[model samples]
Target: MGFKSLAGKFYAGIVQKQIEYQRKNAVSLQQKIFLYIVGEAATTKFGTDHGFSDIQTYEDFKKRVPIRDYEELRPYIDRVISGEENVLWPGTPAYLAKTSGTTSGVKYIPISKQSMPEHITAARNALLNYAYETGNTSALDGKMIFLQGSPELYELNGIPTGRLSGIVAHHVPGYLQSNRMPSYTTNCIDDWEEKVEAIVGETIKEDMRLISGIPPWCQMYFDRLSARAGGKKIKDIFPNFKLFVYGGVNYEPYRARIEESIGFKIDTIETYPASEGFIAYQDSQKDNSLLLMVDAGIFYEFVPAEEIFNENPTRLQLKEVELNRNYALILNTNAGLWGYNIGDTVKFVSKNPYKIVVTGRIKQFISAFGEHVIVEEVEQALMEVARKEGIDIVEFTVAPQITPADGGLPYHEWLIEFGHAPYDLKGFALKVDQALQEKNIYYKDLIKGNILQPLIVKSLKKNSFVDYMRIMGKLGGQNKVPRIANDRKIADQLTRYITN
Candidate 1:
């Protein structure tokens, strides 16, 4: 083994032990992080206003700080943007993570110096744990590609501001810099297509081994690479390629197509990362559930998914969460976000070491007829049908069609782009609809009571989603179409690309 591989294996062993220790004492570790964050930020303006100094226990903290979203916390964030010190965290923030918001125009999530390590360390541990489990550290010696946003950042009131991925680009560890592909100059291109072209040109002939990014963008990269190589599968071009590290979306929907592009199935690591914090990562390949980051610099709270919008929701700490129950994830991070609702829901699959599966976004759901169908249910339904029928789905989204032009009962509409169309398209749609009904009781009830009709599947022209995203100026990076929406904002626009 080379020096890099040897060093990686050694580090992986150490981190594996540390992770085991943290999992064993998850509750105590969370308590320590809670106290530490509260103590560290006790003198900040937000802390003073919330009486953080007087907060003695979880109950006290809960009473003092109410749960808040971006809008509710905007006043303090505004003060920070105006160059105020000690407004949110101690002193000034190290950086501001810029992200698109649904209600708010653009959200600026503070990333304090103290909190920055949480992001970096968790990412590092993800790969290290992979090595520990699989006994594969050769990727550390080969080229690695991370398809992400442009690293070019601008200052917001003296604080570096950019997309979370771009901000993270600046902090790539020194050892990995040499192995990382696509030159810094190429990575700074503002236009995503141009940037991908640059990346293809830069890394096409290199020893590319590890590829990481959100699924759709990675699929785009794979397409570009294959076209450049005269339709060669990725594995043929880069024989050493392995280890696909991805987050932001579930990999099941895109897995078949992604594997086809590569010409073979490869190992993958799923992660749950957000602007609020690096929450969890898949620790074992055998177990698909992500191990929650209990020892990370964040304290977590869970509110039953059903009670998320309640005036007084039941908030449970780490030790209190039950298995198989959907909970809205709340965070109290070292970045000075107290009682913060991150808008994601999770279901615990295992409570022994706190492993969870991301259910869906709290806000992104279809409930037009009071049938509250979530992303997980929809994805699961489609995956079941696709797997059974051997269909290749490029991209898809679900929205309620409240008004039908044909004067039929309103029903769910699925806009799908198929790489390989199903032979029995209607049968495929019916199977997916039946699967969805099985997954959601409310949806089943609606179908049974004739309140809603079986879903309609509209085949979208190839590259329709790409075109939509391009038109919206969100072609690449971490941007993804919502899996399900209550309204037709996205579905209506997508109609223009419906295959005749």
Candidate 2:
């Protein structure tokens, strides 16, 4: 093994012991973090306004602080943006992570100095945990590519504001800098297509071992590499490539197409990260569930998914969460977000060490007719059917069709772009519809009662999603196509790309 691999192994051992301790004492660690954040921010404007000094228990905290989304919390965020120190957290924020918001045009989330290191550390520990678990540190000896946004930042009140991925690019450790690929100049390219082309040129001749990105973007890079290599598989282009690290969207939809491009199965790691915090990462090759970061300097609360829109929802702490139930994730972090609803929903697979799976976004679901089918259910149903039928799906989205042109019952419309179309499209649609019915009872009831018809599947031309995203100015860097939307806004525009 090389010197770098040896050092990685030794460091992985230390992180492994720490992981074990946290796993065994997950509740206590979370409790300790909760106390530390409250005490540290007691003097801040938000803390004092929320009666943080008078708070002594979780109940007191819950009663005083109501759950608020970005728009509701904008006043405090505005103060921070206008150059107020210690308004939200103690001292000034290190950076403002700019993200596209739905209701609000643009959101600038604070990344505090105290909370910044945890982002870098959590990511490092994920890789280190992999090395320790599998006893394979060879990936440390070669080039690694992280497909991400531009690292260039422009000042927003002199706080180095930019995309969260861009902000993170600046903090990559010195040891790994030599192994990181796509030269700094290439990464700063504004256009994603141009950047991918530049990246392929830079890493085509290197000893690439690890690649990381959101799945669709990684797929885009793989396609370019194959084209450049005169139709050779990705595995042939980079024989050393072993690990695929990804987040931001469910990988199952793209897994078959990606593996086909790679020409074989490969080891993969899944992570749950957001602008707000690094929530979890896959710690075991044997298990797909992500190990939640209980000790990552953030306090977590969960409201049952069904109750998310209610006037008052029950907020359960880490210790109170049960297995397999979907919950709207809430956060109270060192970044000064109090009772903040980050919009993502997660389901706990293991309560002992607090492992979770991202279920869907709180707002991203098909519930127009009160049959609230989520992203997880739709992804699972479609993937299961596709695997059985020997089909490959490139991309897809579901939206409720409230009114049919022929005056038939309303049904869910699935707009899919296929890599390999099934021999019998009608039969394939039937299987997927049945699978979805089995997964969601509300949808099943509507179908059985004749209130809704079986879902209709419409195929699109190749690269339809790519073209759509490009047209919308969201073709890269943390922008994912919505899997499920209650309305037809996305579905209507998608019709123009439909195959005849």
Candidate 3:
């Protein structure tokens, strides 16, 4: 058999086991995960200090380790960086994923030897699940063009650190590596503009079969590829392109733009991989919900989104979460992230198979006037408006314009970068305003009470967000335009450089 067939069979076997285990029983899965983690990490300092030795049950485990975010793990991570062994896990981490610190400067997420394989396995299974469920192996026979981050890795006190996609890229098996595009040299380009040009030159004529990356960046690539083809859609450039694997941000708003770039509809698979670990993925082509990776070397916990910011909040285990409620994710992974808050919100859609959809980031919202507009709501509103007005937006960001100097009442300021501008800009903005009012009562109340004025919409010059991300040094891969800023900090900054 060919290697692709063999690999397909191998991935099929593993994914089958996963789907079966995923549906076996939530309680049993959780128990097994707890035992696996404690057993593997019991020798580590953090584990032993937290009484992993005597922790025979979930209650015991939870009682010992309080929930934490990256801030709370700073000391331990610092120790690990300083060459400490077994600080959080059984041994030193193989690498640290340098995540976007737009909120906190930079976050170094440890990827231990034990946990790295689980991540790879989970990623592998995401594709395998898609292939198996669809009964299509054409993608396996063709090359994949993963629009990954910089492939360059840097060292921090003897440990490797870089974007997670970059770190993971270095480890793609030799067989798959041969089928990958953007050659290692091109992937290492640190500058986004230069890198995309180089990638366009390299893969525009290649028999690329799959494309994967954050939606905004992918749109940039597709646009450039179309330009290279003399205005032909990206599908003309890559006829074999079958699957578009994406994650890290909402895809709803970008779907129309991406499909337009593709010249037709295409299959897509979504992943929920945080810097901490691969959490969940779209397992079936028939549905939109993602299946949780229940057996993927991570113990899961959930805290109701409403109570997550409170002084004390109840943490709910896997089976304890109800359907259709936003909950913040917590993880106790084999990587030694003990009860760590990943900071993304999700809502369950199914219990029989434990399916979920990512809602938004815990910190990614606009709430300057108590009108808490979240990512999901804003994205849905944008999509709804775009559909209504026949407009195509490349990317956008919203923030509260709270400077009373502009007007007495604060208003939401949107800086929208468009691929195709609407003929009726005013009507487009009005539709978004009405849609958001329909979705968020607090925002409606603010407008009704005259506490906030109507939203201010600014059409940005093409490539505004692109230029901004390039300036911030966070252009490609999982990096994306922040949908909502806590204040006008980012909005004002972008406006200074990109007024249309």
- Cα lDDT of model 1 by residue, 12-91, tens digit: 99999999998899999999998999998899999999998998899999999998989998999999988899987899
Local distance difference test, each candidate: 0.93, 0.93, 0.84
lDDT of 2 by residue, 42-160 (tens): 99999999999998899999999999999999999999998899988998899999999866888999999888899999999999999999998999999999999988898877788
TM-score of each: 0.99, 0.99, 0.95
The Cα error of candidate 3 at residue 37, in Å, is 1.4
As a whole number from 0 to 100, the lDDT of residue 63 in candidate 2 is 93
- List candidate 1 segments past 4 Å from native: none
C-alpha root-mean-square deviation, candidate 3: 2.1
Model 3 segments more than 4 A misplaced: 1-14, 404-406, 497-500
lDDT for 127 in candidate 3 is 83
Candidate 3 lDDT, 1-500, residue by residue in tens? 35695678667877777677667776687788889888888888897788888888888877888888888888888888887899898778899989866655688989988778877888888888777777666777777888888878889988999988988888787768778888889998877778899999998778888888988888888888888889998877888788899988878888988998898889999998877888998988789899898887889999998788887788888989999999999999878899898888999999988999999888988888898889888888888988877788778899888875754778888889877888777778888999999999999999999998878788999777877877876777677777887877678779865654
In the order shown, what is each candidate's alpha-carbon RMSD? 0.8, 0.8, 2.1
